[model samples]
Target: MVSLREREAELANETQTLQTAADLFDASVSEAANLGQSSASVLVALQGRVDAAPLATAEASRLNLLQVAAAAQPVSIPTYQRASIDEKDLVDVGKAIDGVRLARESLPPLVTDVRDARSTVTAALTSFRGELSNLGSAIESEAAKAVTINDSASQSFRAAVTDAAARVKAAQQAGGDGLAEMPVYAASLDALRTENARILALEQAERDAAPTTPRNPGSGSNTGGGTNSGGGSNTGGGNQGGSPDTGTNPDPAPSQPAPDPDPEPVPDPTESEEPPIIIDPEPAPSGTVPGATS
Candidate 1:
């Protein structure tokens, strides 16, 4: 039979454990929800990319057409006079020359239209590139966030599992007739264990369900190597900002000059000098011959 004090202490410990487990579980749930939101955002961003793909293709076609037209050389004609015997012949010849002149005049507008189309396509291409870059960055950022959430959840779940296991072992050690004597304590412990198990399962599932890291489309490598002639170096550096070797001091910055050492303390000349002693003349007050040998 457990004493009241022992039972109370046990209940207190169990309650504390339950509280800890509840906190961990709540954190895990919050993290999971955040990850879900991030994933949804990524999906929406990707969908936008998909929708823009066709526009990019169409723009590319228009650009190519305009480029071909822009490269075309203009044709020139030499003026020629036709012999006319009557009014009918002159009118026919004039009509034919007018038709040729109209066609020649229309060519310039065609060229202008082609140039404008090319410019429009080029702008569209620039926009598409920006969209793709933004989408890629967003996806990578979301993936990193998801990874962080999962890692934190994993740690929390492991800690909860360890705590619950310890409590269950302590309970068994207390010898309480198979957990029936302390119903509330037993129930709390069981609840903690069950929650911990659920957390572990969720962690595993998340791990398994995680998407593979995306690679650059142009690069054949799975490690996201971009297509730069300067090897696999990231053109814009790492994710955060700055270069990859930001902290590494292989070469110190040239702007910062080396610090000078403290100057040696100069010995004070006055420290070595002796203090002058003042000779007080003997009090001539009472006296009469002050200039005497006193």
Candidate 2:
């Protein structure tokens, strides 16, 4: 018959093994962080352009993306910094191997803690990688989000352009009342032009990403990618493992129990990490609310 002491020994081993595995998990995360950083760089650049754009454009979808990005803060992924033995709550069954009653009562619980920690680490990696992928895809294809000026929209688009041009003209030939509305009207026209130019730029970028690929001999799409400012989330679990160590045993468990001779008792894990705060690229500073339909 397997002695309770031996079984408890097995549980202790499991705990240490899992803690070691958790330490290595960060290596896997570093690669994901690198990929996310690439996408983040591009996203930031586009955000800057949007910020400088005139508020008259009133692009709500873009603004919403901005808000989301702000909410999904902490885009930077960190590598493993922990080096010390992370067996804080991990029960050292070896210490209690001689205590049959204690081992029976405590060993199983230690295994539970070990398994949970590893699961937490695994889950965090999955979520972190997934978020990066989503954010990248959103940005690389974001140019598609602009309002399309197709046949249905052409009338409104032309009207806006005409109105803006007329306003600029009136402003230039300012008289009494005209002078009062001169600056306002002229500023509005400039905003309209900026919006128009943005539309054109997006179209150009789209064409660049996947240029018309001929079906015959040499084929190429020459595609261009884009970004949505709603920054990617790291709503994943926090980095697992303890502080850095020099291959030494971790400190004894802090919690008291007549169980482990050395290792400490683990408490129920409070798993979730902080939800990141996304940096939003706000609209232009001209205090212009979006009212025009461009």
Candidate 3:
């Protein structure tokens, strides 16, 4: 037969143990719920990736077509020649060819990147599914433990009450007035009721915080930039400047007109009229003297 005080003590201890177990169960449930949510988020991301795969593939195909077009057609030379192209047509052709070659060379890596993205999404989905399954199992097990603890605590509490009641009845029978001692039993009953209420409150809090189904997982953990379907980065090479020779020439500048040559001077007309006049000769002193100097 347990004394009234001893029985009260045992009940208090049992209640404390129950409270501790309930707290641990609550913590476990929270962790499981978080895990479940994370798993769900991973799944959603994975699905998004899977859906995006085709778009990435299409983009890669488009790039391939661009490469082929670049290769087949001359970039600097048009079907019809233009004034701009005429001066440096050969140089323009070389630059255009180089540009097309660079574009074509870049396509292979882009395609590979897209393929890698598809693989990552698939792997993430599989991992998320596994984690969700594990979390579900853990939550179920913790719930079962909580149930068992609750049952055991209830049984212990009831037995403690009965034993305390029996002890109070015996004490009353051995004394003068049972009513006079009733206050003692009532006080014990009140204490027991208070302890039970505290236990109930703790249990309620646990249940309120428990995880439910249809959990929502958040976003992905990766902090990197956006990748194409092949898992390659979207950014490409830097821009090179225009041709230096075309940019620098000073003469015959497109903005200025060409200089005119100097005009020829007019001929004098008076020279033709004055050229016919002649002088008269002196008389011949002698045929020989006429031509001789005196």
Candidate 4:
């Protein structure tokens, strides 16, 4: 009887556990149904919103406006060229950030190329600056060298002229002293002097050897003819009664005077009327003797 009672109690406990499990199951089913209804309502509301909104129409309008602008402007889209960037866009931090982000994303290679070009330009500028600085120094150095060369040339020219003058003076003195071993210039001067002296001596000898003519034998005048047979000689001595010998001397030494002839008997003034004969000697010919005249 004890064993049968223990079995009945275990059966009742098992029935209660089963009833509790069924209640938990029914509550979970109801919660699931409520969740499904709420989800369906949210989905219906979202569908109504989508159906009523003008998003597509507005987007189409925007596209149409863009096309009209493109037709009016006649500009190509997705072009690399830009006319201008707005000041507001550049100054606004948000816009500037967005622009930079877009640029980085879309044109990474262009950005890299711009950076590289800027670096190259900077390097070129630096190199050009250095070259200009070096050019200044080079020009200064070359100018100094030119000055040195000019001074050297001037000094050299002066020295050369001085030496040449000294040599010329020495040559002149050597020639004046009649040195046999003188320079060519000195010898030439000596020869010229000798030739001049020889010419002078020959001229003097010719003048000395020339014959001089006697003047009229009766007149004191040396150039004019006179009726008097006696005239002055070339030496300014008293004239002689005859012509002189043809020699270098125009007049010989004075000799004894000739005796006067006897006077003729006076003719009757009415019977003789002829004039007295006056004898005047002619000028002697060259290299010939002159005859005596009475």
Candidate topping lDDT: 1
lDDT of 4 by residue, 252-286 (tens): 34789999999989978787597788999888877
Tell me the whole-model lDDT of each prediction, alpha carbons only.
0.42, 0.39, 0.40, 0.38
The candidate 1 region of ten consecutive residues with least summed lDDT is 176-185
- The order of the candidates by TM-score, greatest first, is 2, 1, 3, 4
Distance from true location, Cα of 40 in model 2, Å: 5.5
Expressed as tens digits, the lDDT of each residue in 102-141 for candidate 1 is 4445445544444454444444434433443443333334
Q: Which segments of candidate 2 are over 4 A away from where they belong? A: 1-12, 20-43, 46-97, 100-107, 118-124, 143-294
Ranking by lDDT: 1, 3, 2, 4
Query: What TM-score against the true fold does each predicted structure earn?
Result: 0.24, 0.25, 0.22, 0.18
The C-alpha RMSD in Å for every predicted model, in order, reads: 44.1, 56.1, 50.7, 47.2
Candidate 2's residue-wise lDDT over 37-109, tens digit each? 4434333333432222322122332333333333332221212222233333334433333454443455455
Instruction: Give the worst 10-residue stretch by lDDT in candidate 2.
Output: 73-82
Q: What does the lDDT read for residue 160 in candidate 4?
A: 36
Candidate 3 per-residue lDDT over residues 1-294, each given as its tens digit: 333334335444544444444444334334333433433333333222223443244333333333332333111211211223332466755554454444445444544443443344334333443333333233233334433444424654544444444543454346421223334333433445556678888989999998644312222222224332333333322112321323222233145777898889766875684567788887776556665775
For candidate 4, list the clashing residue pairs, or say none.
216-231, 217-230, 217-231, 218-230, 218-231
